[model samples]
Target: MTSKANRPCVQKLRCLLSVAVGILCAQSLAFRNVDSAAFDSFANLTAKGLDSIAQFGPAGSIALAACLGALFYRIYPNFKRVGKRNQLISVILSFFLALSIVVPRLMKLPNVSFNSFPNYVGGVPKWHKPIFWMVASIQLLTIGFTLAVIICWLMRKAADLVECRNTGEVSTAIPPTNLSIWERGVRFFDGKPMHMTVATLAMVLCWLPMLVIQGPAIIGVDSMVQLVQFRTGHVWDPMTMAELPGYVGQDHHPFFDTYLYGLFDELGLWLGQEVLGFRILIVLQSIVAALAIVVSLIWIKKRTNLPDSCICACWCLAAILPAFPMYMSIVLKDSTWVSIFLLWMVAFFEVIYRCNNNHAIGWRLVLCLVVLGLFSGLTKKLGIYVTTVSLLLAIIVIRKQFAAFLISMLVPAALVIGFVPMVVLPALDIAPGGPQETISVPIQQLSKVAILHQDELSKSDRQAIDRVLDIDHLKPYWQADSADYAKHYGYRLNASSSDRKNFILTWIRLFFRYPKDYIAAVPYLINPFVYGETYYYSGPVRCGWWEAGGSRILTEYPECGLSYTQGKIAIPLTNALNKTPPFSFIGSEALYTVWLPMLALGLTISIRRYRNLCYLIPTVVSWCSLFLLPAHQVRYTLSFLFVFALTIALPFAEVLTKERNISN
Candidate 1:
């Protein structure tokens, strides 16, 4: 039998989903498409102190209003106010009426603000009066409105079921409280796939405790560099006085990421007490990550009807997956990017198949694609290009999903092609500085070649090599095991374009003859991406790190502290965990999620169950993009791994479901 939902059921489900999404959107929409700094200013004031009462004073009233709104919708259907055909129309109208009231009231609700003490720290800029209130009003009102709409809808739905059971008629009355917690949960998740629900709850339970001991997991100097760059508008050289651009930092590290995290830092400033603000941010990150995991499982469960145990196993793996919580709590760009990319997969998974074969749902998913596609694309410099290429490849493979995927990418595709160059660059004064490939890939290979086959170099070749690097410097670097030969002792620091030309020619000449030499150096230079090896030339171990003078520098770096921050217990524990096996595998400089796409490729080729390569493609490309990067850090890929893991496993669960269906 086809899995498309029945008409009445589809409408009801859409209504319910819309309300749920609507409520979330209400609070979140204001934050969307707005300047990050405005929120930062709001958060800054909040950090100094917003009264606890002002923050949560409306809970009871808002809850009551929401319950009432749901009641209005529930009973309006029974009023006998309209004939059979109009019944659908009346119900729709009632939902809107309820929302109309709830939305306005919620928006008007009072929320805590920085009116009392606007400045968060000693010198950071404060929010302007108008922007501060605009942001706060949007957030506060949405909270109130969404709560009422959701509570009202939920209570009304429960009341309908209770009334249906007791009196053979649905009603608007409150639901009875005698049901067991399990039963209430069943009602709550009535139409949801059981496996999906289980997966969500499991992830929630797994990440809960980390909050109690949640310290900041500052991996290295990158986190500190970001924190410093945040205070300034642009990507600033932390070491340079007056924040002059550092030597080849953001270009190598991905400057767009600095922009994204800078916004988060602004939020941290807003939330109150730097440490506490960050913890809140971490908690928010965990929640969203869990939600993404849940959404991926739900989409999979819908497709496969996965067994409870298989779903449980998925959850178990997610729970133990070392990177999940570690990356979530850390103030890293990867964490946020991971969540966005995963959620984008939700639209991806939904579109490739069918959602009750509903066009409206498909359209909604496409709209989401445009927003998520653009946001995620713009977040990292290469993200848009990588994702665009992947989407094109996906269309070729999944011919059936071509229309949906094409429509989804149209807006973003346009912006990338036309807008980014003409508008974004000139407007933002974003200099076109990116991958210094002249140094990263070729130089590393040359260092390997020079070290392994010094005798092979002719006198002219030796002179040409010297133009790029002092061949003597290669010896000490080899002994020290420094992978970066391009920047050692200011190698290539002042080479003219002709010198660059000569070095490239020499690199290519040596590349063909001593290919094995290049092959030998590949292992460690790409160590972090290939496996979770944390041991490096910087030392087999150090607690904190950032790069400088072409080296990984270790230092204490929280950049900020808090009463409830997890820096002490969390940081040392994660670092210690990396030293061991099992967990050690998770420590790879590449994203742990990288394995999922690799696995998916293997399975998609062999097992028909694992065939949606769309989700896997971007991540695979992301992993490839790493080779182009100057450094090899796992944080670069950690944020993007979760979605694919869920997607790959879900297909297996469905394979079992398909087998069962065939047997039946």
Candidate 2:
């Protein structure tokens, strides 16, 4: 019996293969007159092939709309509903109607060809046969639009499922009664007062100086055209007086600046003024970000049952932190990305804890995913890391939605792993052209320079230098340096492949062996509080009270606060009584005294009450990860520091409030 079943299965497979071969033969016969080589070349044409595709653009777009509409209608039962079906059909018809109307309009306009090609080149094979291009383009558009529709339908179905589970029984006419006072206050304020106050104050204090540095040029007081031209292309000129163009491009790694520049370009088209408009957008985003922070506080307060005042205090601490002002002033992507992330976090918490409406949660999550995907794609690649971590955490934390979690995670993961490789990598040309080689010019030159001055170096320093040059160790350092250089330059180094391999290996070994050397180079990684270049401006100024403290007292103060106060002050009588130390140890003791205790307390409280406050873990992990990355720059660390401070301060403030309430 088993043999008979296997024989039939094999026969069926063979029959299917025969049919497939027959179809292929028929297709070949149908196109027999076409030159195979010409057809092959046309099929594999490059970007120029798009022109051929455009000939049937209208029909292709309409076909695409129809196919996508049908696919979506099948996948989503909601679309099958009478009202939904009508809406979807109307949308599809309207899209086609618009395309039909627009095509004629497009034809009437100028051809606007960026390339000059003769209408017909005799004896030259066309890039793509016009009819073939039309059919292929239509198919491509149909598949693309179909996939989009399917995704949207899947999201809608998921959301509806959640809604059914969470709110199916609730009456639409009834309002929820369990609202918190904080929520009420949020509604009362209309969300502007808190944001404007925080952002304006931060900008005035921290960023005003930098803006003044550019002064009249900002407001078009100088020749606007000249200013724009100077800033755009003269990015590298020392004479331009502006800090080297922060924007990353095809040539360099100004990671955060690239996103800002992209945003500037986008807003410029809409606002009609590029530079001034971009500045206004930055200011507005900062304000919105500040407001989001406040709204998040309110959401947290409502959900956690924490006091409004405590949450507000945490928000204040975060906004007023010294680094906060400086970061907000610059049109960098980090601050904006962080602010958006915070807002998402707030929405996530609201759905998870307060709303209890899974449908709403699903929609919010989808919105977050879309925002995250676009932002990550446009900004730094680190957005991928952020999204991955968030997704994994969601899976673990919301185990009931494990299936949904897996599906949702796949969207971003596919984007990063698939689209990145297929699209972004090719566009950027990041793939190695050949076997890698070690390019050790940078390391070799540095080592040679050091060797020349060996006699001038101390014995210990000399030995350390010698260790760095050992081929086994040096290979890793060289390799890593080459890779870094490539990343920095936005292109692979042109060198022997072996040199690239050796350079990478040498850099890796050096990095692990003397991690501090590389890590210390990061601006914010070391001591986040200290602003290196602008340390003087950032430090506290001396006042009358500090002058009253006298010399010995001032000497013991940390460099940051030295101008304000030095050492412990004691009256002569008090000093004479007992020789016991009057103050805490200055350096190490002072450094750890505040931050360590708070960190320890915060960690202890958070972990012990993880179930109750697990949301805080992401905030903690984000900051700690920032610390561990190569650059420990203060600005980078400051972003997480504020997160940490807010986490701890909010709870501590609540405890104080509770105690006061009991006393009252």
Error of 2 at 16 (Å): 96
| Residue 99 error, candidate 2, Å | 66
Candidate 1 TM-score versus the reference: 0.55
Give lDDT: candidate 2, residue 244. 36
Candidate 1: regions farther than 4 A off: 1-205, 216-219, 232-257, 263-272, 319-322, 354-363, 399-422, 429-434, 437-439, 450-485, 488-510, 525-568, 575-623, 629-631, 653-664
- Could you report the Cα RMSD, in angstroms, for every candidate shown? 23.8, 29.9
- What value does the lDDT take at residue 475 in candidate 2? 34
| Candidate 2 residue runs with Cα over 4 Å from true position | 1-275, 315-325, 347-361, 393-398, 416-421, 424-525, 529-607, 627-630, 641-646, 649-664
Worst 10 residues of 1 by lDDT: 112-121
TM-score of each: 0.55, 0.42
